[model samples]
Target chain A: MRALSKKWVALLGVLPALALVAFACGGEGEEGETFKIGVMESLTGPGETYGTVAVQAKQMAVDEINAGGGINGRMLELIIEDSKCNAQDAITAYNKLTDVDDVKIILGTSCSGAMLGAAPLAEEEGVILFSGLATNPDIANAGDYIFRTSLSDALLGVDTGNVLWADGIRNLVTITEATDYAEGVRRTTVEQFQKRGGQVVGEERYPSDTTDFRTQLTKLFNENPDALHVAAQAEFAGGTIIKQARELGYDGPIYGEVVAIGTTALEVAGEAATGTKAIITDLDPANAKGQEVLTNFRNRYDYVTLPWYLGSAYDNVYIAAECLKQTDDDQDADGFRDCLYGITWSGAIGDDYSFDQDGEVVGLANVVVEVLPLAERTQDNQGYRVLGSAPAE
Target chain B: MELPIIGDIIRLSRDPKDSLRLSRSNLEFWVNLLIISWAVAFAIWQGVGFAITVGTVFAIWAILSVSLNLVVGFTGLLSVAHIGFFGIGAYAMAILTSDAAYEQLRTEAIPTLGWPFFAALPVSVGVAGLVAVVVGIAFNRFRDDIYVLVSFGFAVIAFNVFLNWRSLTRGAFGIHEIERPAIGGWVFDGELEFLALVLVSLAVVILIAWFLMTSSFGRVLTAIREDEQATEVFGYQVTHYKLAIWVISAMMAGLAGGLFGSWTTFVDPNSFVLMESILLVSIVILGGLATIWGSLLGAMAFVLLEEGMRFLPFLPSEFVGQGRQVVLGILLVVLMLFRPQGLVGRYKL
Candidate 1:
């Protein structure tokens, strides 16, 4: 038995070293055949729902660009690595792309935490990290190399605060998930609300993985505030919060951010989700290109969880392809960044949205949308009816 | 006839009369030397970025695994709270080193000492050790499975503190752009330099673990592991032994966490989740529980396996992430079937 265990130990010791050699030898890839851009996405873990959509949308755009003669006659290939919606995996994904694959430009990272985790490394290495889904306000200052198509939660907070005051909500109560993105939304919105002299009656927080919010909800209801804000990291949490709030007999007006107003959240909350207003940057339904992108995405994937992120992700690929065309080199991160700074384009996300000096998206504003009745939900609008632009602060 | 290396290792702590066993163990030591030399050579061959990134990661995991082996493998304690110490160390590093990383983004001012890395690292390790001592004193009475449950509770509470302590940890948004270690004149900004620093730290940790394992104290630990009641009846204070080893193990894990935050230049609550603690336990288990070298080998294999899955060009990109997890599960199942004592473990949990 001892001898056999020794053999197993020897085998285990030799195997990993052998595998390393094999991996090292096989690391090289054919150069100049494709513009290999890295895609660091949360393809698994808590962010998978929207993350999967982001990946599919990017792939669809990559296929389209390749089919239409590639990025300047070289095929555009994305080396997708899952970040798993955390810092550790994001750093690992970033290192693999930059060190092993040697890609200069990376598009993705679905969650703000993942983006934040990888941003410092990208900034230090002079690699361009562009995201379509990450929306923490702090990302605006991450570095020159970090850019995103998503609107900053700071802007969303502003709109949300304005909408609250406009709707005559003076005293507000909040139940927020303990996460970077959710906290950003809650903090910034509260800042704006307090600046307008709106009093916050009660506040509660729950961890990201937690499902039970009854105690927190009871505490908030006891305050009997004029309005309640549900800031959740995941859609299920948002749905459950709304469902439970109704079950607790709090018929007061409830508000939330884009994730809370998502199709899946509404599906989870069912009838309870109706009349819940959200501040979100949504696509204009009448825009031809936007409709085309949405139609094609529906046709290809047969489902859309976060329509805006899909649009943003699709636009990111097109934007990247255009930058590659202008720079004429896949490795020229500087030239690509300059192209982003100089160019303005109309896309599915918005008409002629350009990046500011800080690489934050400009020319796009958030809107207030209300969840429709459960039976009235559609795949197109994701069960929400837009109530026009959010009132400006 | 006994196998040369295994027989030597098995008899290493006993039967000092076997000169052949000594010679064979020396050969095993040389083999270990050769393996490390090959790794360093490979790193040198693979440019600065790959070497620094992978090497630093390997160093971190190796430190964590080896130290965990001291508690779980040597002292017969199953600790799920090692990652809590790691997180504490990481947060200590972040809070001490930089302020602008999150201060600019946050509305409220979070205190940042902005101290140098080396200066702050000791405090981080000390804090982890202190917490471990406190928890050890409280829970040392409960042995077996109850100890595991209590330790698991510590990990969960630590995770919650990291997640909800907005003033201290910046909550989940994470502190980014942490400063690298620097001396008076020069900053260790280069990847190769940082990798070297981490490896040196890992070596120090391994040395400490070795010194502990070879001492009379180590023999007592083994005795305790073999039979706690017998050890206590022999007039040995088992709780003191357990607490001392636990503190040392936690401090080592804390040191690794500090290096990890410095390497990535980022720290967040998500990285220290219960799943990560479970992953650490898996690393110790896979590498072989009572062997320091096994921890090193196990970390290398686990890191390689996870990273190596990406090298397979044939795996469809869509299923690659899930495929990696599946392959790891299958490997563990196979290893359990073949080697129930782990790849080189002396004791079975």
Candidate 2:
């Protein structure tokens, strides 16, 4: 009995010490000479495809900045962590980044859930958590330190409404993935479309992991609206929805959000995806800098497909670099946050783009893209044709 | 070198049977108290705010694991839907106390009472217990494996309701700006204060669990777990005992969930998924079933292992997050192989 008690006591004594040692492992990065910026992406989950692209874009930007004399002569190092696109994982990743790695500026969080989970912690820790692709409207007011270069779903929803209205689609039915990203877009689009004198005939939502949309699509098809809006995170789901909707024999104009514009949609839906339109942040093919980025990304990755947030992620790294360059004290989180708030620059995405007080990117122009046949699509495009820029709100 | 009285106390604590006499069984009790107190003091002294926050979260998980142990460990019922009760308490507290609830009320043009955090606790507990009664009545018909399946289904259904019920639960967007617990104008806003609240709650929960474990009612539960048919032949209504214990366990889980929602100041459907329920079961199994203190140790070990993986220098930064789960999987396998009953558990699987 005494031996048993001693064994238990010994185990208890060792466990807490192990915890303390874990907390004490990571040494602080050298002051001012090497700026450590953390990156939290969903590297190995449902958001893996987009996360991989976003990380590549961020790395491309970081390499460019280093190649051009670095950020104020201090080499920028990115400490990347996976969020797994979940709130709990995001919090853990955030804690490690702030406490262990000691990074003040964080570029991350492709998913809305990840951003929301880390926002309060970032606010408390006084770290600047800037997202490359999180677009949930709730994030606009999440924290003073939380900012995003990507356009909010609110803006994209309004753009979708305006573009559909301009195209003379009067009645619409919406199908959304039951995630924060897709739901936010669906809600805002329905509201904005209704306010613009367009009628929403019906709306349906399904969980993110769901593969079968036959029931929902069949039901939406019964409404026989002028258009069907697909609000989904993954292109596979979006494409499946389109293919299944077409199989149901309702061929009215199909609209998609920013999430539906990638090559996955085309690959899954095949020829049925042609003529599908989406509201996407226009990447100007004519611009020299945009072409340069496109060329570099293609050469490095050997992948023709570009996810929606690739441009935003590329531009976010430059934004963080520019913010660090402008700060009087680069080491101060508050100073870096303030400098980020005040600065504006044109990059691969567009011109004169800056963050508003709520940390939303200002003057982000949206354009409508029509999925065209392989032969009709430009060499620069995967399967999309830029169908004129939408009027800026 | 030990004194006679101290030696006796230690011997009494190491005994497998539960005891109520403080003079005989105070060793385990005092050791647990000292370990918790020392951990709290060490976290604060380290002055690492993240460590404090993680410690508070650990306390919350400990509370949950202990409550779950009441049903799964003591009663031998594989109730995986404990997270359902947790979600119920969280959503109930969030809806009853949050400013969002007030706004929602105004939007619906309904009258609002706006319950405070403390006032909301009983409501949350009652709601969880009430739901447990309904589920328990329906589920008590099923035996062993079927019960596990039915209970797991409950967790999935509850998660869906929390996700799709936008009018009440706000669906996937989650309720934000939840008010932290306050006492006579002193809000528990800081990490230390929140940690203190969590620790106090854990202590109370441990006391309740200990009391129950050492009582006649607890012995009946153990009997039911060992052999329901034999226990029933002894003139006990097996269903009633099961239902009663289920309700108590659920109410305890609800209390823990209420604390969690307020501590994080946010509650989303994702926080209470089937994975979370599995995690609670793992905590009990790892700490050793039928042992109250084992649950606490299991929670500590689990949280420490998960968080400690972040500090492994051998793992590259990119692989560290996912690699943590890999290492944890290996550790659990090794533990099961070496110590199947659990590290401190007296019961055999």
Candidate 3:
């Protein structure tokens, strides 16, 4: 009984500390006076590069809007939470944002898994969950409330297949990381490529976080295909796969998805990254609005060299703010969602921004880019040279 | 002056030997009863939304932790592949109740066998038990350290199967829109309803564990854990005892997994990883090995800690993402240094 009492005492001692902590962090804006928006991102995990840059881009948009005297004289308060690129963490973050912070609309989720995991919850709660960069094909019909600013993996895969076939690469060998994002792209690419009278000679899959791809690459190279299609979620692994394939004496062109069109691939693969082509959704660097956003992003975050999700994230904030402006009641999630669906605004990346019935970005164009060697790459170039653009439809 | 049941419970709590037995006590039993009652009442009063949802998850974890304790705590097997059974159960329930399966069956013009949650639950548990029997037979030749390695290896193999088996498991896209447990025209769809179901399941599992641990069979298992060679000399078939308990524990984990999948209405490979198995073990060790009550306490504490650490004051916004894990790590180290036997454990690791 004494021991039991002591245990009770210990538990009692811990409760106060928890209460204090909760009290300290519990700060909400004045009710109904400001437009409260929740933001979820992988702020500290492997996907931190995209997440941190996305936050910066959103902040930049928010700053611009506030400087223009706010959204119809009402302030926009952004409550950001870190998802850590894990599904469980994403759920916890979502619950905290909805229950504790009491935010109506959420903009998130750079990672596909995080976005998909939280989609059901958002739908159940009748809140809008808009993603800036999640590209998994499953997310298209995840929930009515779920939407993304990025193009779907299915469209990107079709475009990639077209690009490969146009380049006279008839036979292909593919290596994909075992994830929703990578596998979705790989499956669709194979399907579309096969429909266009091209054959996938060999295909290999490796688990996520696997740095060693020699065994899979060796098996793939044995097919002696015209090109190797690498679908990886992490840019570093994509670059490493290309370098390892080169080391194994495969001199054919390498193809990748949007995830590979970054400095990580160039720096990690070195000279081997040269001539590697990828499909990306960012605007042309030469475009005025694109160059302005990129310049501002570069100045703000000196470490981020690539405009990966910067333009999309910047555009998402502006789009959400625009939707909030049209709503008579800022607290009405349904009204905000309806307004978002009806929007057709021009943004930095495209001449017109709109969403289809499925809430995916409509008329989003995919640009094919190639990696240039270090000596040929410019300061603002980040090693990727745009080759051509494909219709997103 | 004490009432009949109340007097008996007090007497039980006062005696150390009686307390060590699996019987209920006045203080401990009432405390747990009150906690559970408070949780239900709180959910009801608070409208059964987010907190109840989180509580339902905690209940499922508690069940898994208790089930794992049967192997790691009572029997000292140190099985690390428990989540493999968890995955199997979740996948089984998912496949049985999934609308995706109906779509596939329609393509073949075959009638859909979209079984209800209750029907799938028992099948999932049975499947996990059968798999455990196979694994136990394969690894019965090995002992101790080798058993641990084989169990760890099993988890890796199971995870890879869950990942690459795109035809059945749908790979990383996951099986979505799983039907909740329902009767004729009545579904346990609300958070409070699910919480009630989970609590009932937890109570049954705890009662069964208590009954088993108090029996002579449980004593023999403990004797084997203390000294296997000595127990073998006493005419006990140690391998059979270990294998039986392993299968039973695995089935319990499967049952918990089924409940979890049904409640979440989704199942994916990411939920059943090696890290989750490790967390289950930590819950058992942290709560108190060799004590069923400890498993419950450990699970609740772990969940609360994970959620509560997010609210820590004065943490820089940048560090908030990783700070919860850091705080948990520091707490675990301090606990290990101070109370290696665990917070409520009767035995030391």
Q: Which parts of model 3 are misplaced by more than 4 Å?
A: A1-15, A24-29, A43-49, A82-88, A391-393, B1-48, B101-113
Tell me the tens digit of each residue's lDDT in model 2 across B1-349: 1123345446667863543344333344544544455456445634486677678778888888988888888888988999999999988887887764334321111123467889998888899999999999999999789989999999999999998988787777777666688899999878789889889988988888888888999999999989999999999999999999899889988888888777766677778888889988888888778887788877876776666555555565535556666877887776666557775565764
For candidate 2, write residues A19-67 as lDDT tens digits: 5564455344455577778999987666777677788888888888888
Residue lDDT tens for model 1, A1-393: 456546555654654565566565555675768899999888778788867888889999999998899977899988989898888789878988998778999998898888988888888789999999998888898889899999988888888889999999999999999887888899989989999989999999998777878898999999989999999989989999999999999999999998788777888899999999999988899888888988998898777768888999999999999999999888999999999998798999899889999998888888889999888888877799999999976
Candidate 3 lDDT for residue A351: 68
Interface RMSD values, listed in order for every candidate:
3.9, 5.7, 5.4
True contacts kept of each: 0.50, 0.19, 0.25
lDDT of 1 by residue, B1-349 (tens): 1123455545654765675455543534434444455566555644567766777788899999999999999888898989999999998888889657445564434776788889989988999999988988997888989989999999999999988887877887777666689999799988778888999998899888888988999989988888999999999999999989999999998898888888777888888989889988988987777898778877876776665555554556666666666776786676667756654565788
Summarize candidate 3's per-residue lDDT along A137-207 as a digit string, tens digits. 77777767888888888888899888888888899999998877888788778877888899999998888
- The CAPRI quality class of candidate 1 comes to acceptable
Q: What TM-score does prediction 2 earn?
A: 0.87
**Which digits, one per residue and each the tens of the lDDT, describe model 3 over residues B98-156?**
76442432111112357899999999899999999999888777778997899999998
Task: Report clash pairs, candidate 3.
Answer: none
Candidate 3, CAPRI quality class derived from DockQ: acceptable
TM-score pick, better of 2 and 3: 3
State which candidate has the highest DockQ: 1
* Interface RMSD of structure candidate 3 (Å): 5.4
